[model samples]
Target: MFNLVVEMNTQKIRKDFPVLEKGIIYMDSACVSLKPQQVVKAMNCYYNEFPACAGRSMHKLGEKVTEEVSKARKIIAKFFNAKPNEIVFTKNTTESINLVANSLGLKKGDKVITTDKEHNSNLLPWQNLAKRGIIHEIIKSNEDNTFNMDKFKEKIKGAKLVSMVHTSNLDGVTIPAEEIIKIAHEHGALVLLDAAQSVPHKEINVKKLDVDFLACSGHKMLGPSGTGILYGKYHLLEKLEPFLIGGDTVIDTTYTTAEFEKPPEKFEAGLQNYAGIIGLAEAARYLMKIGRKNISKHETELNKKITNELLKIDGIKIIGPEDPELRSGIISFNYKDADPHEIALLLDSSADIMVRSGAHCVHSWFNAHNLKGSARVSLYIYNTEEECDKLIEEINKIVEL
Candidate 1:
């Protein structure tokens, strides 16, 4: 087996996550990653030092909060190669996508295209828009659950917006986003990417992709929960109406009328999660330092090891593409006639291995395929070869029963 644990400095990385000391193997990063001590300390610094509202208070504490929050915004923007003013902070990826769905002002008969393999966050918003007379179209995937470019091309004829998941949490397949975005633009359609899974494991430059809008959760990237970002081009953000309007969203207001703040500020309403923002920025910095390319390589190596071993077991059915490279760091599979939840329980109880089960918020895909669910093992930078071995050993034992 390849020894990437040392090459990736995974032991040193594990030291930053205190939860790893508990002797548990965590392979569920697709849902929420374990926050490092650096992120926690950054958040603690915010609460303990400033503990004041940003852009609202005029006192020293407020000024400090505002400065720190501004810095956090710039850090996050740089992480995605976006302009500072283009970044809008929201509660999570769901809220970010919802903001676009509500603010984009899609009129009756306007067409929006998405893939059949989308997470519910990317799917439901357009479905709700359909209720208001928008035409929602779902392009079905290939037999192997890969994106069908031919189908997408056929559907993109008159689409108003094309919102798709960059990397699927269900099976870890990353669509060809850069090409897709280019084609959508040629068709005079705006593209919004649900990057909740991609941003954490891969390098994504919004400027490079030329995608109109992108949404991702900080919690999935070793940051704090309740922190996420919506990135849009400055001009587009200026044209779209605010999703949630109140307090910080406006510059000044009369009883009858209100003058709103610019792009980002207008979109970010109410008192924000100051501590979480600080933590999320620190998380971005940490990931940058480690290098997303190296992280992707490390996870792919681990996934290769796990996928090869799992395929050796009889009655094991792997999901998505057969190639581990295409699936990134996720291995989702089912044993014949086995309940995925029961398999998850067995792994947790017998080996202290934490994995995800069920449809992983892609219930529509499961229903379409007539499947119940599958156990998912998702890897991250901190995961090691030893842990992968342990997972394989435990899964082998479970299959025997």
Candidate 2:
């Protein structure tokens, strides 16, 4: 069922995002979303009312900051169906993934399995660690940009870690996470999912999904930049070696060995983006206000029409599923002779449509599929059917040009 939140409360919800009043049709949510007024106000409040280093100072302002951070943590944990202590704030998605690659206690002989459809943030950390003597294996996706489930099962025999993107940036396809986790856990392998492209568009229950680790960027989901989050199981985080070690991360440090603070605090080293974190909390709150279920339905409703309309254009080849229900609010396509960046320029200048261009950091997918480059039109809640119509019209003009 499609959600009617946007239709039912358009006036109230649209009021929250001041940029919506400026009359620009934004279609790049997969790249980065525009922030809502509520998030802006929340960030301003942090800087104006109570801005201090959380968990460090003892003053009232500092305590207030601490309480604010704690509140955000609890809110995020509840959103992800995780425990408060299990969540950690990171600078971005890359940092969150690196935390696992650096601290997850993988041995020299340990094998980590990844997908062909991974963003660089999810793929490179472990791949770069090959110099450290860890074995990295990439499970290729099918021709349709979906995972080869049987092949995925084939690679699980010797893998110690299964790190994958829950939703792909290149194709905007959502993988079946529940099955992925179930099969991997049976092999005693820990699973790490990059939810950067899925969190805002899908209904996620990490607890029910049985994933050991998940990472997402706040900015991509209409929150402030320089903010990302990592969700780990409570016990797993307790045992993890802190990836970033410094300042507030330690209980006691000396000339000798240093003893670290517990779980999340130990993992969070130094001063964080107080304003960004607060903004993210407000963004989550705004989503909660509208109900994520409704958001998902509305997005899916738009995706179906957009995907079908786009595929009908000549020389256009979509990289992911033909069915909109199988993907999120992303459409990756390429004209026969046009470079993706060139196409993006045309779309921006001629149609005023903003999009992403290139391999989208999924180099493996491009290589396997023989794509020179691709352009992506990523949508969000604020995007409308009228903009999608314009996109299709522009695509027709580009193809005929």
Candidate 3:
């Protein structure tokens, strides 16, 4: 039954992405996934049919917009096994992380822990806080770039918060979040997962993980760009000072003061992205229907094929783990003495293959290791074996050159 479902989803997946019709092999899902027709249609419906503000107006179209936005929130909440009130909409993962960084109420001298491999979105906010007297510490990864739980255990002591990446976009390596979250809770530290890379490819239950907060971007999960979600425990969200205020965030305002609304409304300031929110919900719905396990499995198979073929070529260095299974859908590598951007451009010109190159927003890691950058090929459910073959072929040519 599972195989049948996977087969069915695979057959229908390409049709849903209109960009695939252009015969281009898209391998940059780690940066931004191609949106599906369902998500596009949902956003279009919001703009064309009931284009109005949500939660303010009482007219028919306004009410419809309000209802639809509420429904989107619920769908997104259910997708992560979170309560509707616990979910807060933000522009993207960057904004979501910044929201928590600014609002989490960490005092001077309070210790905060993070992994060394965090993206700039997860790294900069804490670094800024450190400049203001918050003791921000980083736990370096193992030699293979895997999470070092021992280092984490040592660093986590006296930490008020542990904000780390659930999956490293730099290498496609996922940390053991369940174990990390458990240890953090035992130490009385609140846990916030930078789940921008994990949530779209796997099933994540915020309650099960016992994560205090989680942040992810919709654009990486077949949703529209400029849409993202931040999920927190209801109590934690309630306690947080509002990151952005004014407009819909307040219930009543006086000349002296303004009374704020609760949880989600308080966090989502000003006018919301109504159409983007609707599209994001549809994207979540589409992923649920397709099954995240299926997507993960399909991506791993492609990665294995690519990794095996690439290994046959001399001086072709792959990042992260030696095993493709450990890297999820990503295969970030570099040819000997080759500029990653030049290789990316060559691949695009030669084979119509699109891949991401350079530091990938994790410049700290590259700088720490005294390296430049690597070419990354990130996959998704819509990718196929033929696409992997073309990638291998082009990469082989690039290496030969």
Q: Highest TM-score among the candidates is held by which one?
A: 1
* lDDT tens digits by residue: candidate 1, 305-385: 999999999999999997899999999999998999999999999999999999999999999999999999999988999
Candidate structures ordered by lDDT, highest first: 1, 3, 2
**RMSD in Å for all candidates:** 1.2, 2.0, 1.6
Error of 2 at 213 (Å): 0.5
Report how far off residue 393 is in candidate 1 (Å). 0.2
Per-residue lDDT, model 2, residue 365, is 74
Q: What lDDT does candidate 3 reach at residue 108?
A: 97
Model 3, 302: alpha-carbon shift in Å? 1.0
Question: What tens-digit string does per-residue lDDT give for candidate 3 at 214-290?
Answer: 99999999999999999999999999999888899999999999999998999999899999999999999999998
**Compared with the true structure, what per-residue lDDT tens digits does model 2 show for residues 78-134?**
878888898899988889999999999888889999988888898889878877888
Candidate 2: TM-score? Answer: 0.96
Please give the distance, in angstroms, between residue 379's alpha carbon in candidate 3 and its true position after superposition: 0.2
TM-scores for every predicted model: 0.99, 0.96, 0.98
lDDT of 3 at 38: 97
Best by lDDT: 1
Off by over 4 Å in 1: 1-7
